[model samples]
Target chain A: MSHVSSSPKVRGGRKAAVGNVGRPPVAWALPGILFFALFAIVPLAIAVYLSFCHWDGLNSPTSAGTANWTRLFKDPEFRQAAWLSLLLTTISWVFQTPVALLLGVWAAGRQRSRAVLSAIFFVPLLLSTTAIAMLFHALLDPNFGVIKEIGPWFGIDPNIMGSSTGALLTVAFVGGWQFMPFHTLIYQGGTRQIPQVLYQAAEIDGAGMFRQFFHITLPQLRNTITTSSVLMIVGSLTYFDTVLIMTKGGPGTDTTILPYLMYRTGFQTYDLGYAAAIATALVVVATAISLILVRFSGFGNMRSTREGM
Target chain B: MSIDTRPVTRPARPLNRTRPAGAARRRRWGNPLAGLGSLVWLVLVIVPLYTLVSSSLMHQDEALNGDPLAFPTNPTLENYRTVLDSGFFTMLSNTAIVAVATTAIVLVLSIPVAYVAVRTRSRLSGLAFRTFLLGVAIPAQAVIVPLYLLISKMGLYDSLPAIILPTAAFAMPVAVLILSGTMRDVSEEMYEAMALDGASPLRMLWQLAIPMSKAGISTVAIYTALQAWNGFLFPLILTQSEENRVLTLGLFNFMSQFGVNIPAILAAIVLSVVPIFAVYLVARKALVNGLMGVGGK
Candidate 1:
């Protein structure tokens, strides 16, 4: 393992001889920076700017002058959407984390069946969100879907998509089904990184498998959990495709999370300015969560987790 | 320093001797609860996938009438034929173009950025890296309204470039993060050695950095390609024409177009995944590592 801490000293000693000879100039990053700025940063600014204006998306946007912002605070629909987004994020995290964590730890074993099962488990991640949504949509179709045939045995209603709670849960479940494998992979990677010595020592102390997992695996996976949770939270916040394809935020806005609400206001309603407000709000929440993640993970410093090892 | 790469050549002799036989036995039989949980999840995963494939092969009447869990006694490829005939190839081609173009653009733009960030000590490079670090938080959906405006104003709406440009832009932060993480692993001594031979920065980037960071590059390529292939919101909001419809949008349209034709819709879903499934089969390790890279180390 290379010691990143000693690199500055090495560079200082070689400063007179090499003198940044092989170092790429800062200009090398300009194209990327400019391109990213034009698309990402500029649009972010535009979203915020548009939030304060009223435009139907045809003529120049006229100043709404906090009209959208004030209405946003008063709008029950926005409140519901924000609530639904939070609910979905919470449900998805709860549903996915334990299942993924356990599966990840189990898959980290060297058993042959575990490897094959892991591959099978990864199948969902390969399919597009649209494809997965459509698949579930068909399977859940009240009249013609498979759910009509098998739902009773499990006490699930065939009309799950048409009911409010069911629709939200369906959205959450589908999102979980699609993303659980990715999170599982994260945990699997984290589990493997736990030193074998720790487990061995725990076993020598007569700790059971569950005890070892709780004491050793869970604590070791703290950084991994934070990383996955931030991604999951941000991902659920912006989930659009599945809702668009499956429910269209239907059952009377039951599943209209923030992104879907933003889509409807911006595109379907043609209230682009109001939609931009919703979008801006989402950006703030997502950025705040990410900043917290970066601060907690020390990711902003580009520090490797393996540094002290 | 390839994000997922670890030493695989550790000598096994001493470790094997020290390893407890009970440890190996315990690993196999240790967690019946976890095994049971995995079994339940297996069924959860398999049922829908089974429905996907089995229902696709059944006739529409059979799919609606027959038991969903039952194997089709009269399986057929007619549903596949229906999907193939309904512009599936067009959407497939369009998606392929988007994926390839997005991957290419992301690579061209991000490689230099990552290279400079890793090799240079300038404050500007650090600022550039920090910009991307924050950029990772900006959800693509948050910018769709403005992107639509920008794409329309640029006269690129309803075109592949509209989808390509923004998709690549959104993919930049993760691409740069993964690439720089890998690039930073190129030992300083290697660069010093190249400098002693009078290698320029550009030459070193092309000859040394690029070759050594192949894992990261492939990961970025696969990541961006998957992003473009699976992207729905960009094409949905930015593009308006059938010719511009990518696979995800195509599948979304198929949901309504093949309404009540459950077999055909399932067939479309199956066909859409075949390309990626092929990639997964061929390069599972690289793809898994690439995906793991998304969560960082």
Candidate 2:
């Protein structure tokens, strides 16, 4: 009020003194700054610091220096999990993204038709991951379950968890199934952004469904596709609970991805320091991936333009 | 970063128009195969969900001798009852408590933080936002040991607050990101208009900023609730007693103990899903309103 009422000189003096810093937006900023510092920043610092030590979960651990790091490079289990995470993420994203966009586009073509299909696809996503994992667990039981019930129809055995290859595929396939709805939802929104006139014009120009899809729909959905894929990749790379509930990383350590390995090391083996280091590495890797996705996906630019507006 | 080696970061090729839709359809139209192709995809998804739902209703005896996909000859709620009677109510209550607590904390904390992120748009707040994004990147497993240590050191282990605080912290980040995205959309002129009327910072927030940012706030609030409700790992590691068990942890226990009781586990699974189901069922309208609040980006 005083700033509003004060003379030009007084207001000018105040602005100059403040160096036009806008007073830190302290009213809205302070609480968040304080909360995140305690909750987010502090924990991160602890994780990073603990990464340098060799503390057993129960007691003090000597600083093992780079022994843990060196060991991580050579650990067959780590390599396997790393490969599995990368493979599943890349593969699932491969299968999930294009298919989801196609569905989203088809759905966007009509109203009621799309909503019902969208709801079905989104159902698995909305349900508990545990439920989905359990559902797959029962389905893959190989004894009395449906897969076993029809095991001989294709001369296939119901042995999803019986082998390393099978376990990885089961995890990947289920992950893809449960998560497709997210891509659909994102792609639906992106498809919605494309003007209907663009499609109609294409039709008038004798452009067929393939042409419209390739010429218009595909191009329009680029941002949405990228965002969904990035999310899928991140979720798969950190895959733990689903695998834990379904296979316990069993049939061997074949299924133990980086996250599962991290948990096993820290909690089961009681190597707190080693777990922290593994976690730190996971975090570093995840952060790099996240940066690439957010920066290159065209989202930052889109949002920045909106902000400027 | 492997991103340097990967071609994904490169520009995607422009869509190559090989075959136009009419010509493509004409090529396949007489075959009745395109319809069949889509049906196959739909069936693949539908079959599993159908099997799960139907199998849940089957009596134990029927499930064994009968076709797996058949509707149960005698549908029984006994499985549902057995799960209900087996202390699942407590798990639901505990999960509800944690989810509610976390959601409440996230709403209170994230609103202001997101608001500031929008207003300042400064390097510091930007850095702070990135720090929060650390939560998104760093899987909870990575920091679980230290987090457990931190909680226990504070003598907070196995407590609902132990679960609640970490979940909120983990979620606070994306909550802020989404909220800030929405908050930034609120025009600066609203603040200017309020300042002209001599509105205090607090009054402006209550009267203007919040009301304007409701959609984003709701998105964060609702998503935070979902995260808390479905959260598995934290509660799995933190809670010891049944009294402290969240539904996710409870579901795991129920599955292991009653692993063979298909109906009962199904009932438990059904019961476990009720809160979210109820929310989805009852709040469909609100969800649509909220869904429009955010996009994939």
Candidate 3:
């Protein structure tokens, strides 16, 4: 009020008054800052610290130097989990992205059918991961699960969850199933953003549906594809709840991913230091990949512009 | 790019041209193929959900030993009764509290932060927004050990806040990203007019920003609620008691204890999903749009 009243006397006062009018953006941002600092930043810093120390929950830490890091690199379980995580990430890219693109294209063309299909497909995503895992677990039960009895006729192992490779692949497929709708929506939004004129022009040039799709639609969806891939990669690497519920990294660590490995090493083994090292590595890898995606793929710039829409 | 380079031998096509007789015949074939494709997808989508619902209604023995695909001739509430009787309601209540609290806090905290990030030119808000973006890439699994230690040290262990706070924290980056994006869509003239009418910044936000960004708010609210509701890691690590168990952990125990009781397990799964499904139905559009924002980010 004082700044406003004095603003008429000087130009600088008006600037200061505007800056201090009722409140600046910073005032509104304070709670979020504090919250993020405590929960996000502080815990992250502590995890980094814990990674360097050999501390159990029961006792104070002693410095382990890089022993935890050395062990993390050498631990076959960790290696297996890391490989599985990578596999899941790659499989999602190879499989889910295209499937999502196809679904998105299909959805964009037909509104009513899209609505019904979307409602059906997105159910897995909306339901808890634990619930989805449990649902699949039951559906694949060895004796009476519908899939179990039916799979053998099609040359699929009825008890796929009992084997290591089968378990990993099944979980990956489930992860794709759960998240494809999300990617579909992203691609659908991208498809919508294409100007109708481009398609009309293509039609006049004697381009059929396939040609139009291959040339214009595919090219226009590039950014959306990049964004969804980055998300799927990060999401797959961090996949936990479903895997934990369904297999508990069972059939001898086949389905274990980095996150589940970290959880098991930390909670079950009570080796917080080792687990923290894995955690630190997971963070580093995830952050590095995300940075690469944001930088090389132009995700960061593309997102803000797309989101602003 | 290819449109302009077509062969000269080909005649210029009529715009909005009608299909030739042969093309029309092909179209007749294509429609059935398209229908079949859609039907295949629909079946793929519905099969699992149908299994969940159907298995829940079946007799336990039949679900486990007989044909699991068959509809129950005698659909019973016995499985639901078994689940509910075994403290399902308590877990539901606990989940409700956590989800609602997390959503409320996220919406309240994110709105102003987003508003400021969108509306202001302040370096502080800009820095704050950048910091929030960093949170998006930080996986919760990477920090769970530290979170577990922190919660215990702060004496919040085995409590709902222990779970709620971290879940909400994990949710903030996306929430703020979404809300700020939404808030930026409001016209600047509206803000200026409100200010010219003797409105304070807060007043301007309330009158001009909030209403305009209601869709974004709903999206954030649903997303945060969904996260908190489906959260497993936080509650798994932070809380120890059955008293503190959210629906995820509760259903988990149901699975472990009643592993062979297919009906009971399905019943619990169905119970756990109902609330979230209800929310999804109500906010289906916002949820899709919200996820689109997430992917866009």
Candidate 4:
């Protein structure tokens, strides 16, 4: 009786309590921890060290102390990328949040009618970054692209993703476009989770669609709404693929955001030290943004809830 | 892009007062506006695809100046044949090996780790959990130079393994994050019964964790494949020879060699996109369901 109960109970409890207080490692947890440590942790530490020294990403190495960091602090390109990242992040967050909310609310009440359209729009998100870039690339081509093809009609002969103002705006728009499915999905999930009975009660109170969103839907989806914003914020800072494939920070470096600059510094210039410093700054920015959003949304409390798991 | 600007409220028609008056109006009102809005977006996404495929079929003359919206005047498979015959097979195989190998490693490495992150209870496990999050934040571009150096020094540059390892490393965090969420949903009662039946911990994980998280695992697997196959940076920076080119770099190579054979390029893209798109079509619901959770929290 004693042997039978204790071993099973303790094992079960440990399984239920992964990463929790005062418990043993579960059966499979050990190997998981090892792979992550070897692949994730070691490489990260090595990267941080490599950032401080002049290695050329080849040869032996020489220490640079704070020289790399200091150079990054004063570099014009670095400043531009940082500034651009901030601008894009602000624009995406401010714009996408409201539009996403509106789309989410609009889609909720009309399911069957929106089904085919949902699939069409959803295609972009499921696709390769290669494809999305290609679609816009063809459309935005300076000579005879679709947008250019149609631009004269609107009397707008602008380089939508080629000019500086257009570059960030286009990036923001692309970012917004690919990500709207995610927002719609989360809102769909969260709103569905809100019991139908509640909506019936709200209708009896003469609540309209707009009021329903603010009073019922928004409050209910507070968790997801905040999560979507935080994810977008982080994503905008780390936006790389679109910039790489389309702009390459081109049209005379007009679209150089932080990740693009890091790519340029590290790969193009072989400045390992400076690249690392830039990478560190990016990490700092990403972490700070996450923490800020977490603090604002109270997701940090998830640590406490996670403890219960 | 038309928006359905339907009236949010009606003149307080008494509930159940007029069956035909309200019911008839409601159906007519929402359907067309909703249908019209979606059509605009549908055309937005579909037109390029239509052009891309149609352009490949048309001769160069018809391609550059023909009606952009019309079906190909003389649809042809020559472009498809061009890509398939012109060392395209090698590039296709190269892409397959890199993408398939990366997917295998990520699945093998992350599944056990995800299970641990869900089932273990240790400070070290907690450290590992947070460590995976680093894979997400560190823009891989930051480490490309060192990675290139590292791969090149190890005599792996231009080798398929060079791209495979780094891609898997970058993707592992998200994979684990997704898998752990799926694994956590597997109840402890199920695991307890297995332990009671004298199953080893290894067996328990195989039977319980892996089996339960199948949907989540597959979704993550498909996504990882898509990411690796479409990876442009690694193969671009690491590979040097035409022999080493994956599909993505192959496109760039074709661009350099014979100019952007837009028809051939589009045909190749069509080929590349269809397999993954087919995979998505089959698994669309599972993917969306998985992402709602994965992205939500």
Candidate 5:
């Protein structure tokens, strides 16, 4: 055995000169490709195909040929859902970015107390979204929740969830509360990666704290901002669980973003065809937005910030 | 230039006057405005968490009638008992199985793909990599209806495999990206060294690539596990039976089952978090890094 192994090892050593030594065959990628194709890619194609077919998910799907597509264009609920999804995406991006950026920068500091507080802040991220939604739902219960006692002091109505705007804002707020820490951690990582020399240079130039932040930190985090924003936008566009648990797209479909609308249309109303159309549209929009962001920010290029260094 | 001279002359009189040596060295003296902002956010984070815990410990009557933020006069595990009695364990086990199975599948499948992508210089490998890159933006929500159809057609509806298969599939993109990233870091010389031993590609992967990419592997495992554990839409739409229910759906059902029983609901929420919280406490750096990896870092 030893003699045979030695002979092959010698041959392998010689073969190394040919440059095909230990490279894996492309066949190694087959199982994964087939599995992803079967589940993800195939299902996506079926969704688009079913978008043009009429199926109540019962007997069989019959070709309806642009019927569902036309309905989707003119459906008032679909229009409203599309608009609300865009609005929520904007709200989430606007609300989450500044706070997460600031908190991330702060937590990136080396203070011991900041470390502890950062740990505390990370607690929400550990909880499942279901738990956070449930916790917030219970807290916002008008008759029996903390909101009742605190609303008067804050000059706010306790029945915030009962109104349309309040309900939508509440969804955005709850989602923000759960996700801000994740973005903050991203920003924190980005901040730590910044070299200390930049800060020293700004200090030598008599730049105030605000000026340094505006000029040095902000520009340096441009990639981080794009990354966090893309994530935030896509995340909020598909925001569903909170709507399901808290609002159920209620108070007159006010909070019915696209995902929730898809859920309602497909499962509840049994309009699976229309829901497929909506789902396809969502995929297109999400992919388009990400592609645009990646294109503009050159994030797809994966350029290193420390190029010269 | 004038402003620069003023700060140089009176450096000790401004924000740096009362700071520690470390702060002065880094020029990160506590900004009062930022400090104030952090305090405000601290309150925002703490208040609801305080309410969740405090209310869960109270009797339902106390929770309803008393201040929601007050300390429970007589804290008890009775609510936790209530959650335990209501089949929380079954759902917990189901979630655990889903998480484990999904992680296993994702790792077993994605590692090879990632390895081939990183090691092989071929157009097929490039196409495979781009396939996953595009897969990243295809939200699982978009494919749910067809998945439901496919699962039902395959006789998988209302089964754990129904959840495991799709969840694992969706987690592939990130897992592939992360694994390929780490695999790329395994140096050429290392492969050459292994090749000199007459090692097959499989042996090279096991001995060298896998060991070298342990960080990315662990990150992928954690990401898939969390994705499976917290998955809602798949469970909500695909599965119907209580026997097949996972934790998130279990929590969703608890709302209607324990209606107006706020303490019971809160207790269920807290119990659901306990396992992940324990993991977070012990493996915080790994967990945070894994989550950051989800954003394609």
Candidate 6:
């Protein structure tokens, strides 16, 4: 019943169908296979290879052995960027998850309010990251930005991005704001996959909303939570557009994260090898986290339903 | 919490029934906690946007001198005119071409792999599936260097093709994963019947898969379009000229160029957002459902 595949055993029938259909000569898949190989697989290999060499996008690459790799660990900027990214990931989980879940549950259950609230929330998600960045950037500016003025009214610094702590938190907050709707949708859709019977059963048992949420909703959303967590972490690890637009890893590198760091290094500094090394580290870290979650989290175990959609 | 006094009235039907009256009554009674939560959510999302839009319309002096939160008293389209007159249209066109081309290419390329992966079920198709799944984990930032180099080596450097080709490449992972998942939703018997009709895979793909997976296809198209439209790094690193700029890069350049012209910049940002927002409105459901496919499966 999972919307993903309907049944896992569909594969058995697929295999039988393949036998009768002659499996459409493998050549039929050439164009797609070639595209992936050249673009995805090959580029990954090239990145790995280039990570071990020094190149500046001009001359031939010279073998640098572990020079670039070693330098990444030694470089304080690299370390800071990596740390900030990790912090962003942590903040996303702490802030976005519960908030999105709350709004999502509320939206999913209600009728009239759901449409109104969803449209409001989903506006950010619809706007391009650049637009979101510009919107926040304008609002966060000290001189003319509106949020700065509001900050004084509320006794909080409107120019939060000016301070190191505020910059990091603000960046994380903006990132969360733009994406919370996305996570909210996942949760809303996930809430749908939860059968009404469960809530009805809880109601029949004289369970309160809190009790039902604790005993039913939380457990049922396990896979979804795992999936969004992985997404959030990986998203944080590789987040570039907002940071690039907002801070440019600025205010003394307070907001620098791995992807932006890699970008600045490669594009601005033309340290292709060093950037590739950072890129390799980012991919390794992201892939490792994702693999670990998938392995340990029972990520595919939401029974009788589709996964993400 | 106060106990509900309403009598519970379960539906005669078993599963998938609406909430009983008592439960609905309890929900309708409204939880203050939920109300507070909703109010907070609304403020968080709507306020910043209002600020952006309002400021975009304000005069520069007014924006700088007036209360930032106030709506524009002397609203003007001067900022928008400034933006449009400054080659914003060219950048927009470039962005449109990139987005459209990328989405078209991704759809053209992903459909076959999706069909093959689902119907062939061969080792190679499985490999194709795994390869695509692997690409999902490989962030574009990781391979961007090679992509840059490859695009340059192909003599596509500093051009729309440089951005378009790579954007399409990166989009394939999510696009393929989504399409294949939706394709798998096609019942085995459907494929069997197509095979019994002696349909070539291409015919089945064109006639059946495309029609049946229309929702998934639109989702892929929208996502790919979104990626291309919102693309920054590619356009930033690959294309360098004013003529080659897309909206994301264009907006960046426009902001810095008109630095401190907050209204003009905000107006430009608002203008840059209109097309994508329109697209999102049109395809909102597919976008949501498609995203769910990613998270759900």
Best by TM-score: 1
Residue by residue across B29-69, what tens digits does model 3's lDDT show? 32454446656767777888888898899888778777776
Off by over 4 Å in 4: A1-27, A98-110, A298-309, B1-40, B193-199, B258-260
Model 6 over residues A25-84: C-alpha lDDT tens digits?
A: 667667877887787678888998999999988899999999998898899988888888
| Candidate 1: Cα lDDT at B98 | 95
Runs in model 3 deviating more than 4 A are A1-23, A302-309, B1-37, B195-198, B281-283, B289-293
- Evaluation by TM-score, superior candidate among 2 and 6: 6
Off by over 4 Å in 1: A1-19, A204-207, A302-307, B1-30
CA deviation > 4 Å runs, candidate 6: A1-18, A297-309, B1-19, B22-31, B280-293
lDDT, candidate 1, B1-297, per-residue tens: 122222131223344345575356447543587789998999989999999999999999999888887898899999999989988899999999999999999999999999998888888898889889888889999999999999999999999999999999999998998898778766777777788899899899999899978878887998899888999899888888988888999888887888789999999999999999998887787788777666555
TM-score of chain B of 6: 0.88
lDDT of 3 by residue, A213-305 (tens): 788778777777777877788788887998888899888878888999888888998899999999988888888887887677665533433
lDDT of 4 at B200: 66
Candidate 1 chain A lDDT trough over 10 residues, lowest sum: A3-12
lDDT of 3 at B159: 97
Estimate, for each residue in B40-73, the C-alpha lDDT of model 4 and write its tens digit.
5566667666677777686656655655456888
The prediction achieving the highest DockQ against the true structure is 1
lDDT: which is higher, 4 or 6?
A: 6
Which candidate, 1 or 4, would have the higher lDDT against the true structure? 1
Ten contiguous residues minimizing lDDT sum, candidate 5 chain A:
A3-12
Which run of 10 residues does model 6 chain A get worst, by summed lDDT? A300-309
In terms of TM-score, how similar is model 3 to the real structure? 0.88
Task: Write the residue-wise lDDT of candidate 1 on A1-309 in tens digits.
Answer: 245334532333544666678788889899999999999999999999999999998999999999999999999999999999989989998999999988988877656677788889999999999999999998999887889988998999999999999999999999999999999888877776667767677878888777877887787787788778877888898778888888989998899999999999998889999999999999998899899888987766555444454
State the C-alpha lDDT per candidate: 0.85, 0.70, 0.77, 0.67, 0.84, 0.78
Q: Weakest 10 consecutive residues, lDDT, candidate 4 chain B?
A: B3-12
